[model samples]
Target: MADNDVSQLSASQQQALEQFTAVTAQETKDAIPLLRRSQWNVELAIAKLFDGEAADPVVEAAERAAAPAAARPQIPPPSPLPTPGPSLGAGSRNRVTISPAPRIVPQPTAVSRRPSLLISLLLFPFSLVWRLSNSFASLFYTLFPFLARFRTATSPPSRTQTTRRSQNPRDTAARFIRLFEEEYGTDTGLEFFEGGYAQALDLAKNELRFLLVVLQSDEHDDTASFNRETLINPEVVEFIKTQNIILWAGSVQDSEAYQVSAGLGCTKFPFAALISRAPSSTSNSQGMSVVSRIVGPTPPQTLVLKLTTAITTHSEALERIRATRAVHEAGRAILEQQNSAYELSLARDREITRARREAAERRAREEEFARAKAEEKVLLAKNRIAWRQWRATTIPKEEPVGKDTARVSIRLRNGKRVTRRFNGGASMEEVYAFVECLEYLDESATDEETPERPGGYAHEYGFKLVSPMPRQVYELRSEKDGSERTVKDCLWPTASLVVEVDDGEDNEEGEDN
Candidate 1:
């Protein structure tokens, strides 16, 4: 056997010994199947050596290399091979049989996929409920037009465009101004005023125009908030009252604020409110052109809906007002009815009082007429007595002091003076009075002959002029032509020229001075 190269043991005998020990108790003791298989290879080789087969170093060496190693089994990572096919051979056989491992088609993991089905099932119920509820709600709301016919309609809703947030106040203000200008119109004339709001308010005050402060006052960003000091001042109110100016109040958010602003004072689209196209008016047939507010420009159909809605709202409000008025009238009528009964009871007393008043008025009028007639008779008699007295006491009786210039007067045209004569018995007639002129025998009484009066003559009587009130010679003139007149003696105050015709020039030949 030693001479048989010691390595070449007969394969048939070695196979029989390995098969016997492979099922042995030693291989089974405290070992997993793979471990037992590994130790058995060494155990079988040793048995063969002891059983009269000399150790073949080549076989031993080959067994050491070929046998499975006692090492930690590791889980193989997923293969990158594109397909599952025969990759490695199990044994050295010329005719190879490959048992290809089954391909595991990758599926979605349980973590991501399992919850989706449950969630979908849960949401299905909710969606079903929502759809059902929505349909019912819509159906119910649909009948509101009929149910709420008496209720006032509201303005069609509009949404403000979302503007980008900006830190710059000027940028915000400019954007706001642009929006207003666009919504209203291209502001021409007084449209695009970049002046300060507070300054404009102050300027408006000077012109007797009041400003409406429409804003949330807590916000310092609004100009109206800055005018708080002006708001509470009594003097401001007084000034406003005297100037025929008024302050309007409302929230900026309300449409009434816009309406009120339009009514009072607005720099933009003043003509729009004034020459407003009524909501129902289809064609702007009037020659004046109008543009729609671009804040939320709507098509004609939407605008028509809005118009009808507005009309309905206004009509409702008017109806409410009328209903209130009717209620008030009924109450008043009840009060009047109660009062009428009381009045009916005192009808005889009222008639008696009325008759007494009439009688008293008649008696007073008769007495006044009798007294006036007597006064006229006495005045005429006194005039004749004055004439007799003049005849009796005569200094210039031969020349007749009035005969030298009988009704002397002066006429003025645009302050240029001319002289004439007049005939009557009295001084120059005042502007407010219509009477014949007087031949003044007294030189001191004449305006031109007497120097300019030192005192304000008319105010001494405690009579001030009012509308159509008379000014009684508040000023008098001393002239080179020896004729002068009072301020009131002028034709009109607007024209400051005195034009008394032939009044007193001739009578005042010279002043005593």
Candidate 2:
């Protein structure tokens, strides 16, 4: 290319041209056309140069004209024409000749009638035998599953578009590779990936690598040479390995391989394709696309050239996609962390609210219990005062005036002495009550001043009167029983008694002893 024309190209295109000219050792003017034809692919341009497609016919003719005459290739002489033959005699020899008429051939008539009964009966035994044989074969296959493989092997080949059988793609791929290696030998440097075609595509897309699919047809004449020479060539194998391409090859005889070939629109045997992530313009629905196709047999250099061109063109786009994915992943992780923290804070708030509610309820219950207990104590005190006032009124103003009158002298619990006279019919409880109401006995003691007994209350004296001479005790019974011993029963006539507090200490001491 001219210097001015080269400057008009982009930086990448100019670089590609320079590399192309350097490798092919061709003049800039001569290399531009080849590079343009290969879309500025240096590898492809170099391949075209070595194939002699870059030669100029005008220049070749000029070189031939400048050469000496003796060195030129000799031209062979043209062959002589043949002599004319003698004419045949007429008339005297003209005898009459008869022409034969055309014969009509019978045409076949279409049969629209049903088959005869005799024909059906004649074929009945053969049909029956065929059905029996099929039944026996099916039974055998069912009894021994291993025989199914043999039946498959013996089956006739089906149409290429139709799948023969469904099998595990991994197993199919491994088996194909094993058989390939056995036929081509292990030294074939091309490493075929041992997995299904779909799996290979997924791996290549996720890893941002190129996938090279090599589909071989055993019946094709070019298959053997292609595997032997082009695929195993050192330059081709090294290029594929350096590019980190995922190579997956299979025979067209396999169901998966047949389906792949049909899907990729393979019109020739020994087909190979370079597939990678679809470009941004077409990526909405397509994950991958065929970037380059090499059909029939190709030289190692041409195959490498096609692969290199496709990879170099798409590498930039793949890098951009990878960067976008990393940013999205980082943002998603941060969002998840924030959500988990919020959930923990919400749970802690709920727990604190529950504890406060329980504490408030417990305090309310305790306050209610204390208020009820205080009210009960005040009611009991009032009942005791009312009973004392009532008993005081029942005491006589003076000693009974009768010969059966009894006098008693009692010492109160507060160390005070009290003398009282009771009627002969007075009970022992009367003497006890006389001592109890000694302070309440006054001119003001009256029935109107006394209050009713406390509801559900049973009053008992806290002290008992004891006889000093014989140590006999007079204990008051509960008023609810309404029974009391008379004063004459123990303290008739005259008696000296001491009132002592009836605390439970004596009962505790007795139990301890």
Candidate 3:
């Protein structure tokens, strides 16, 4: 088929095209229209190949008159019966038949012949009698089990009957294989599929191969010849191998095989069927369609032809199905990759959002802390100014001039000299206060402009006084307590005090003030 024409077809349809071409050996141009006519059914398309053609009325009449006998199917008379061979064993019911001459065997009719209702009614009495006799015999055997063995030995040779239930399908399969090898010899060159019926069907369906099912009846007249001549033929073996056909065979005596025969509706022994995946219109519930069936004995040539027809007809359709599966798998893989990428991107975005939120919270806390610290600094500066104003007013304005008074000389940090007098009872704190107000004394000359004392303020002076000659230092703020001793205790009557800047921890607030 042309590329564009094939592309327009669905996967199943494309598969049908390949199958039709392979089986019919038709050119692409011819196969496309033929497949379309069958609605893309491979089996239907192959069936059409053998269908009789429609003729014009005049042409049909002329042709019929010219070759009336030729138009009708030629079914030759039955061939002479083959001679009976030796029995398989003394007690064995199976009898082998020698190979007979090759002859054309007609395909089975689609409709089965059914007896009339009158005939069935007439036969009902005989069937009832037979059932009654069998039931009595079974009851007798059950009662006298030891006598049953003697009865079996005297009975006519017959195939063993079995129940319908599966009794170890694998074992049954293995047993069949072994029996087939023993009967036909291992050199037959044909190998049977090594599994149960269901397993064989699945293998054929999945691999797009043909499954050939052979059911043998040991008691049948033609089974021996069929196995010996037709199955062991070199041409048949080669065709099966080259075409990759899965062969599965079982004897009717086996429960598993009996079930398969009943299911396939086999009417004759030595039966064979070719099965494969086909269009839904022609397939069974399991999607398997029977391609060809050979009942009774068939020649090796006919078997090969039948198998070839089935293989070619279905090959292309399976190829298309495989292609479709591959495409679907690739699409699933791509979808998974896209989903993985999207999940990763989502995770990254979530991480970024969390980090930004945390950073914003940290910045808010830092800004709040700085604002509180600035407010605290303003309050401390106000308290220090109030304490300084209060201390300036409390200093003695005029020098004490009594007998108990003491005179002291002080040098300020500004390199200026100042004289001051204090009472004998005056504490050292009073002396320091006098020096602190010197700035006010020089600026105003009086205490009239002094500020009021402030509450709730603990103040520390930034400068300290020291006697330079002895190197004794006096701090404005006491380490132990706020109390101080009188200056007379250290500089009684006369003393020189030097004021230098204090560089202790108390200087922090003083510098800010």
Candidate 4:
């Protein structure tokens, strides 16, 4: 068969064929035929090459005796053969005469079979008894279902049952303590927090206390000694309590405690770590830093000394931080107060400025009113003077002729007297004009030139032509004719007139006119 025909053979058979060809230095074709004849037994194929008809005992003995011993290479013994029966007598064995014929030994089948059958027969009654017992018990359970509860009550609780019963943190901690005490003995005198690692950290942060985390592993050889000597030491306990440190203990068996150990990169059992916030940390984001670590078994004094040293060093820095914070707070408060004062002062100044502006506006209004009143008085006087002058010019003037004239004497308010003569036909307006001329002339005689007159009769003085006898005032107009009357008609021929200082009523009337 071709080399590819070897692919059909099993892996072991193909390996044996290749070995046979390589050892014998024969072609694959030559080795394949021999391998096929030998049923793929490499050892038997080699043996066949040395002695033909190697399967026949007589022929193999004769060849071994005849062939020179040096010419034949020794072959190692073949592996144990399969058990012989009629199955080995098939035709396939006839084609492949590979090794010596296996010896056929008769087996004592009855002798071996009889003992097993007897043993089974002896154990049959016991199996029947067990089945009957099981049936009875099952029937009892079916009849009285409540009896099942008694069986469960008698049985011990499983791990899952106990776990469910103690799911609370405090219960779990109690159980942990109980188990630890049972294993290591009671009265350990070590205080342990009932909460988890996170709760311990939060307590430490809130109280500003150091966190002492003790991770215990039961598998460690020194765990008991460390707990008894270092952890339970009275001095260590007292110091931790006095320093306000929170102590949290956990076992390696707990899932959360195991996780904490892994995170802290703990390699040794009975590991103690001191954790606290960093000195410069202002928020939780900065997190806690491990201040000191004690591993394995440490003496109580040494552990205490290390913890105290860490506290002293970090405490100084913490004090400094608090002092700086206080200073900053004080400065900020002062700045706020200053800003408030400045704002108050600014408000007061604005109020004062507004008041001053209002006062100035009030004064300006009062001054303006006074000036308007004075100007109104001056304008009224000019109007009255112009009316008097027009009246004087319009009245008819009569020159005194012969004895038909009237002589009028007037007494001025200054106690001066003035006498004027008018014809009997002259109007009374002429007499009033003569008195006004006397005022102007007298002012001009004393002063270099009188200031421009406003043209009304001086309101300070008023004149009326009154008769000394009967004390009758001259009428400005005739009652009968409703025309301008002559002075002779009012005073007749001669009369005395008086110029008197007017009272407030006359001055108001003059202004109205």
Query: 410-436 in candidate 2: lDDT tens per residue?
Result: 876656677777887766777776666
Output the number of the TM-score-best candidate: 2
Stretches of candidate 4 off by over 4 Å are: 1-171, 181-189, 280-286, 321-513
Estimate, for each residue in 81-188, the C-alpha lDDT of model 4 and write its tens digit: 233322334423322321111111212222234448778899999989999998998899889978855553333222222222324445556767777678666766
What value does the lDDT take at residue 337 in candidate 1?
A: 96
Task: Provide the RMSD of all predictions against the true structure, rounded to 1 decimal.
Answer: 48.7, 24.2, 17.3, 36.9
lDDT tens digits by residue: candidate 1, 388-487 = 2332222232113343333222222233433333222222333212111123334323335333322222211111112223433322333445455543
Better of 3 and 4 by lDDT: 3
lDDT of 1: 0.34
What's the CA error at residue 200 for candidate 4, in Å?
0.7
Model 3 stretches with alpha carbons more than 4 Å out: 1-160, 163-171, 174-194, 218-238, 297-301, 316-513
Ten-residue segment with the worst summed lDDT in candidate 2?
Answer: 95-104
Q: lDDT values of the candidates?
A: 0.34, 0.67, 0.67, 0.63
- Model 3 alpha-carbon miss at residue 75, Å: 45
Q: How many clashing pairs does model 4 include?
A: 2
In model 3, the Cα lDDT at residue 508 comes to: 36
